[model samples]
Target: MKKGFIFDLDGVITDTAKYHYLAWKDLASSIGIEIDLVFNEQLKGISRMDSLERILVHGGKEQAFTLAEKEALAHQKNTHYVELLQALTPADLLPGVKAFLDEARKNAIPCAIASASKNAPFILDKLEVTDYFNVIVDPATLKKGKPDPEIFLKAAELLGISAKEAIGFEDAQAGLDGIKAANMFAVGVFSGEELHGADLLVERLDELDVLDLIRR
Candidate 1:
């Protein structure tokens, strides 16, 4: 059977989640909404806009802004995120992650990025690993987010592989849920017991035998 690998972006690829947290924190503070660690946990694996909306609504401030106003706020948060990500490069690739990607390519095992991030492609370009993934399933191509399976399932479709033939590399419970919903095995990286459903979990990105798993 043909095999492929899929990955999430934020926590999986670069450490952009810190920047995301910062941006959201700033936005929440400006709106007099506290984005505590508890709120941050709820925002995991969810879209930026969705997270902001949730914060606003849950804080009883959603009605304060018009739709266009809310969009502007989301855009401003994205600008902050982009600014923080300006220093990202291939050198920032996680320890041994690039080596694993290279091995997968050398073994003819296809790969894709199944990210909820709309900026997945841009981030990959900045990291110079855009060529590593044969396909990238981003928010622009899907209506549903993590835990829905649409994104992962679409990635498999684009990679021409079945869900069972793909390994979904995730860093959060939502991503793991999406992978399992698509009927594929999940590889959790550094997440807590929330990722208990993962078929295989690793403490770091460098701990996997990419070629062995794909070929076997």
Candidate 2:
């Protein structure tokens, strides 16, 4: 039986990917890095620092950045992202996300959020979905990001559940990898190709029957 649910915050819980893409595009343009949305996809479920490094490397100009220069540019991008997120409203939430959380809670299944964003708590609070989770494993508490499994594992630990009993819901490929690494069942949302490590894939959150999914 399922005991817990670990959710990814960005594309899975809130529609923040567009804002992140815009911020990264702004930063890339400022630094002459020439990053596009395709390149930005590589940064999903990754830390801002790691994302910047990968963006620079992919753009074939990583060596051009000094530590200080990288920090300044990444900070600038964060400023843009935070400003954009300030306009976040409840309507920005993904379809069926709220209902899923509500149903999970009603069913007595524990729910938690595991996100690479250091701003995870802030975004959750803004969306007013924080109360739906019993615990949240965010960037602030973890040294490693997704694909490492530490974040998802920590969420399971916090919810007092075994990894096998926790289902991880994620939108990014990295997050799927993390769930696999943690020995949990992964339910991939949004994209099909990104569900490489997931046990199942759904185009929309509400499309999946939670009880039926857990059975498989």
Candidate 3:
């Protein structure tokens, strides 16, 4: 069977989650909305607008922002995130990820990024690994977010492979849900949490043979 690989960006590719946390933290504070890492957990694998809405709910400020104000606030957080991402380097590729990308190339499997983050392209460019992906899903073009199958389905479409022939790797519950919903095999990269729904779960990418994830 032909196979393709799809990856989620933030936690799966690099550690930009810290930058995401810090940026969101700054945004919340600027608005008098106190937030902590625990609250930030809700933002994972979700779109920026959805994440901002979640933060608003946590701060009890959801009703305070008008549609225009909400958009402006989300833009503010994104600007902060882009600033934080400026420091990324090739070393920022998660341990073993580059090797796996190389392995995919060696084995002739197509790869794509299926992430909820709008800054995915910027980060990939900063890391100098933009060439690895056959397609990078543009979050701005999507009407739905993770836990919805749209992102992975779109990725598989771009790869010209059926969802059943693609393997997706993710580090969050919502991502796993979306991968499975798309009828693709799912692998969860453990990031300290007990992610329960993947077809296969491993602590890191190096633990699994790339060929196994790719075919059979």
Candidate 4:
């Protein structure tokens, strides 16, 4: 039986979250709302529009901006994010991710990306890892966000595997929730702290026992 591994993009495959944070921070600053990393954590695994809404709530500008204005802000933030992403290179991949991809390829293990970022494709291309995926579950097509099973389930289906036979790696609570809610085994990837709710938690991707999962 072949097993599948689905991964979240931002912090799991690479550290583009910094670019996202910088972009969002710039957007907030434009609106005279100062945001810090501590508050930015709340935007993880969220949609672009949702992030703007959260920023408004945090800035007490929720009633100040109309829905259309908020949409424009989201667009402006994405523009900044795209500008930051232009500086990305293959060297920007978080440690061990390329090696992990190589190992999966050598073992003939299928992999797919299940990221909430609409820029997932762009980043994968920018980082030069687009060919590694069997299929990427596009977040734009989904009506629901992470912590919902839709994305992971779609990834599993695209990979031609059962959710039960899949293993998902995530760096956020919402991603973990989504993976488990899909009935797939979850591996929580973290840094400096162990995330609670996964079947296993590891600080880095290389620590994953891919061969063990294959042989089991």
Candidate 5:
């Protein structure tokens, strides 16, 4: 039975993906690498530095920047992203997100965030749902990012649950892969071909039957 729920913050809880895209696009354009929404999808669930490296490689400028330069670029992108985040409020919670979190709370199901973004806590605070989660896995503490299972595993550990006892929710292919790799039941929130491997697929969290999921 699933005893806990682990979530990916960006797309799963709120729509920070747009802010992320805008920030990355701004950075990419400044670096002469133009990226559209399609390209931004590839950056989802990946670390900031990894995303920057991908953007650099896409522009054939991967070898042009030193590690220090890349770190600076990543920081620049994050600064803009945080600025965009200032507009976020509790009302920014996506459809069914607040309701589902409330249901989870009523059911006494522990919830944790396993996002690749280091700003998960800040985002949660901005959304005013910080109390809904029992743990927010610090991306800085992980040795690897999504598709590596490290983040999700760390979230489960911090929640005082086994990976197998957690149900992981994600909106990206890499996140779903990481959830499965961590031995958790995967719930994909996107209706995309890339999310085909999820054990339970839904376009929104409300579509999931929480009680049934827990009993599985």
Candidate 6:
């Protein structure tokens, strides 16, 4: 039985991906690089610095900036992203999110956020669901990002559960891979065909019964 839940924040909880894309797009443009929604998809479930590094490499400017310069660029992108996030409201919570959360809460299931986003807390606050989570694993504290299992394992640990007893929800393949690597049941929340190894796949969370999932 799954004793706890771990979720990816951006695409799983809310649609911060747009804001991220916009911020990155602007930053890339300023640096004489161009990125589209397709390219932005690769940035999902990764750290800001890693995403920036990818963007730099995509633009053929990977070695053009020093570590300090890269940090500054990442900061600039975050500043813009944060500004965009101010527009988020509880209404922005994705389809079936609140209902699923409520179901988990009713059953006393511990829930933790295991997102790549450093702005997870801020986004949670904006969505007015800060109290719903038992833990929010800090990406800054993790040495490795998604596809490494570190974040998911840390979240399960913080929730006082074994990784095998936790269920992880993600919209990105990297996050799904991480959950599986952590020995947790992987729940994929995307319509894409790429999430091949998920234990369960849904276009959205509401399609799955919370109690049923936990009992599996």
Clashes of each: 0, 0, 0, 0, 0, 0
Residue-level lDDT tens digits of model 4 in 1-216: 448889999889888888999999999999999999989888887788888889899999989987788888899999989999999999989898998899898888899999889899999998999999998988888989988999999999999989998889899898899998998888888853347789888878888667876654
Rate residue 22 of model 5 by lDDT.
96
| TM-score, cand. 2 | 0.93
Off by over 4 Å in 6: 191-193
Looking at model 3, residue 78 earns an lDDT score of: 89
Residues 182-212, model 5: lDDT tens digits: 9999999983436768898887899877899
RMSD of each: 1.7, 1.6, 1.0, 1.4, 1.0, 0.9
Give the better candidate number (3 or 5) by lDDT: 5
* Model 4 weakest 10-residue run by lDDT: 191-200
* Collision pairs in model 2: none
* TM-score for candidate 6, residues paired by index: 0.98
lDDT of 3 at 15: 81
lDDT tens digits, residues 55-102, model 6? 999999999999999999999999999999999999999999999999
Candidate 1, 122-169: lDDT as tens digits:
899999999999998768768888889999999999999888888888
Cα displacement (angstroms), candidate 5, residue 152, comes to 0.8
Model 3, position 214, has a per-residue lDDT of 61
Candidate 1 TM-score, true structure as reference:
0.93
Which candidate, 5 or 6, has the higher TM-score? 6
Instruction: Give the alpha-carbon lDDT of every model.
Output: 0.83, 0.85, 0.89, 0.88, 0.91, 0.92
Q: Please identify which of the two predictions, 3 or 6, would achieve the higher TM-score against the true structure.
A: 6
What shift in Å separates residue 211 of candidate 1 from its native position after superposition?
Answer: 3.1
Give the lDDT ranking, best first: 6, 5, 3, 4, 2, 1
Model 3 bad stretches (over 4 Å)? none
Question: Taking the tens digit of each residue's C-alpha lDDT, what string does model 2 give over 1-216?
Answer: 778899988888887988999999988888777877777788888899999999888778889979999999889999999999999888878898887877787778888889888788888888988888898775766878889999988999999999999999988988889999999998899653445867878876888776775665
lDDT of 1: 0.83
Ten-residue segment with the worst summed lDDT in candidate 2?
190-199
